[model samples]
Target: MRPLTPGDVRIAACREGDLVALDRHLPSPSHPRRYTRQLAGLGTLLVAWDGGQPVGHCEVRWDGCAAAEVRGVVGDCPEVNGLFVWPESLRRHGIGTALITTAEDLVRDRSGPRIGLGVKDGNTRAAALYVRLGYRPAVPRYLDRWSYVDQDGRMHDNADPCAFLVKELG
Candidate 1:
C-alpha cells in the first residue's frame, strides 16, 4: 500500500517481479518482453506495490516525433503504452490514480504537453478512469482489429475495437 519510486529499494529490487505482474495484466503483443523494451525506450515507468507485490503499473513512451499514435489515434503526442491494476486489488482504493499521477509528473518534467492512450471500446470502467484523470476521446469511434504477432508464432487480432484517449499535460 505504498508508492514505489524508480530508484527506491523496493522498485529497484523488484523489476522482474513487476514485469511478471505487468505480463499478467496486459494482453499478448502487450506482453512482458514487449513491455520491457517499450519501457526501457520510453524512459518512464511507475508501479505501486503492496508488500513487495506489484499491484498496479503504468508506463509512457516518447514515440520519437512530437506526433505519436496510440491505440489508433494519431497526433503530436507521447503515448501511454500501458496502464494496469491487478484485478484482486481493484477495489482497494487510490492505486490507479496514484500510478497515473506519477506518470503525469514524469511527462511534465519532460515538457510534454499532451499524452494519449487506447482502451478497448467495451471497457467502460477503464475508459471512465482515464476520463476522470482528464483524458478525452480523440477518435470519433473505436478502431477495428489491430493485429499483433507473438514470439510463439501466434497471431492475435485485437477483436475488441479500441478508442483513443488524450490528456493535456500543460
Candidate 2:
C-alpha cells in the first residue's frame, strides 16, 4: 500500500457500526463483540478513515482499565487507550497520530490539564510517537496491562510490560 497523505485521512468519533473494523483489528475473530461493548463504555472512541476506509482507532476512557491502571500516577486523568492501526501496511502514515490527536481533543473538551496513555515497554516506534507528540513517562514506571473477555465471556490476556505516559493539554 502506498503511504497516505494527511489530507486523505479523516478522523472522527467512532460509530457503533465501526465494530466491523474493530473486530478485524483484534487478534482473533471472536473478540469484537466484547471489544465493541468496551468501546461503548468509554467516554469517546475516535476512528481514522483513510480515503473512506477505516484504518485506525483510539479511545478515551474516563473510568475504565486505563484509568484504573493510572489512578494515582496521573491522578484522575482520562486515558487514551486501545489505539490501533490495521493491516500493518497502513502504518507510518500519521493515522495513529491523527487518532491520538482526536482522543486528546476529547480530553481537552472535558477540561483536563493532561491526558494519559500507556505504551508497551518494547514497542519503541509507538513510544517514540507518543514522545514526539508531547507525552512523558508518568510517575508509575509500569501499570497493569489490558485484558478483556470475548463474546463467549472468556477472558483473554493482553498483558505487556507497559509505561504510563501523560501529555499536558497545552
Candidate 3:
C-alpha cells in the first residue's frame, strides 16, 4: 500500500451512529463503544476516515490522564488515549500520525497546556513516533488501565506497565 499523508485522512469526533461502523472496522479491543466518553463530556473519540471508511481512532481525554501516576505526575490535562490504526493500514502509513495529530488538535483547541499518552514499554516503534511528534517522557512509568466490551458483550479489563509521554502544545 502507498503511504498516506495526513491530508489523505479526514479526522473528526465520533458521531452517535459511528459506533457501529468503527467497531466493524477496527480490532476487537478497539470497540468504539468502549470509549464513548464523549457522551459524558469527558473526552471525544476522534475517528480517521478515508472516504467515509473508518481507518483509525484515538480518544482525546479532556478530563485528564486515567493512569494514576500520570495524573499525579503529569497533572490534569488532555490525554491522547487509546490510539489504534487498522492492522491493514499498519504503522507509518500516516493513519496513526493523523489520529495523533487530530487528538493534539482537539486539546490545542481547548487551550490545553499539554497532552499525554501512555505507551507500552516495549512498543519502541510507537514511542519513537511520539518522540518524533514532540512527545517526551512525562513519567518514567505508570499503570495504564482500560476495559472493553467484546462483541458478545463481555467486559474485559486490562492494565499495562507503560511509560508516559507528554507534548507541550502551543
Candidate 4:
C-alpha cells in the first residue's frame, strides 16, 4: 500500500465493539473471532484504522508475557507484545511505529520505568525496527517462553529462539 499519512490512519484504544467490527479485517489465514477474543481479555489492545477498516493491531501486557512461564522475563517491565499489521499491503507505512508510539505513551502515563518486547530470532526485519526505536537486548540471550493459540482454537507450543529487548521510557 502507498505510504499512509497521519490523516490516512488513526490509532486509538480498541473498544469492546471493535472486536466484532474488526472480525472481517483481520489478516488472512487467521480466525478473526479467536483473535478478537484473545485481545478482548488481554491488556490494552490498540488498533490502527483507516476510517472503518483495521489495518494494524497490538497489545500491551501490564503484568508480563501472557505465558505463565515467562511472567517475570522483563522484571516488571510492561511488554508491548503481539504487534501485527494486516493485509501485508498496509505495512511499511508507519502504522507499526504509530502503534508502538501509542503503546509507549500508555506506559509512560502509567509511570513505567521502561517497556519490553520480544522478537523472534529469525525476524531480522522486526528486530531492526525495534533497534531503530532504541530497544536493546536484555539478558536471557534466548528464551523458549513464547507460546500462543492459533486460529483453529488449538494451543500451539513453540520454542522459537527469541530475544527480549527493552527501552527505558521515563
For each candidate, how many residue pairs have backbone atoms clashing (under 3 Å)? 3, 0, 0, 0
Tens-digit lDDT track of model 2 for 15-88 = 76766765555344423543565566646667788765777777677663443546755666777877888868
Please write out the lDDT profile of model 3 over residues 64-97, one tens digit for every residue. 8877777888777788877888766455778898
| Decoy 1 TM-score against native | 0.68
Q: Across residues 9-57, which tens digit of lDDT does each residue of candidate 1 receive?
A: 2222225556666555533345554456555774456666655556666
**When superposed on Cα atoms, how far off is each prediction in RMSD?**
5.2, 3.2, 2.3, 3.5
TM-scores for candidates 1 onward, in order: 0.68, 0.80, 0.87, 0.81
Q: Rate the local accuracy (lDDT) of all candidates.
A: 0.61, 0.73, 0.80, 0.75
- Candidate 2, superposed: residue stretches over 4 Å from native: 24-41, 64-69, 149-154
Instruction: List ranges where model 4 is wrong by over 4 Å.
Output: 1-3, 27-42, 66-73, 144-154
In model 2, what are the clashing residue pairs, if there are any? none
Give lDDT for model 3: 0.80
Q: Report the error of model 1 at residue 140, Å.
A: 2.5
Question: What is residue 66's positional error in candidate 3, in angstroms?
Answer: 1.3
- From the highest lDDT down, the ranking of the candidates is 3, 4, 2, 1
Best by lDDT: 3
Instruction: Tell me how far the alpha carbon of residue 129 in candidate 1 is from the true structure, in angstroms, after superposition.
Output: 1.8
lDDT of 4: 0.75
Tell me how far candidate 1 lies from the true structure as C-alpha RMSD in angstroms.
5.2
- Tell me how far the alpha carbon of residue 163 in candidate 2 is from the true structure, in angstroms, after superposition: 0.9
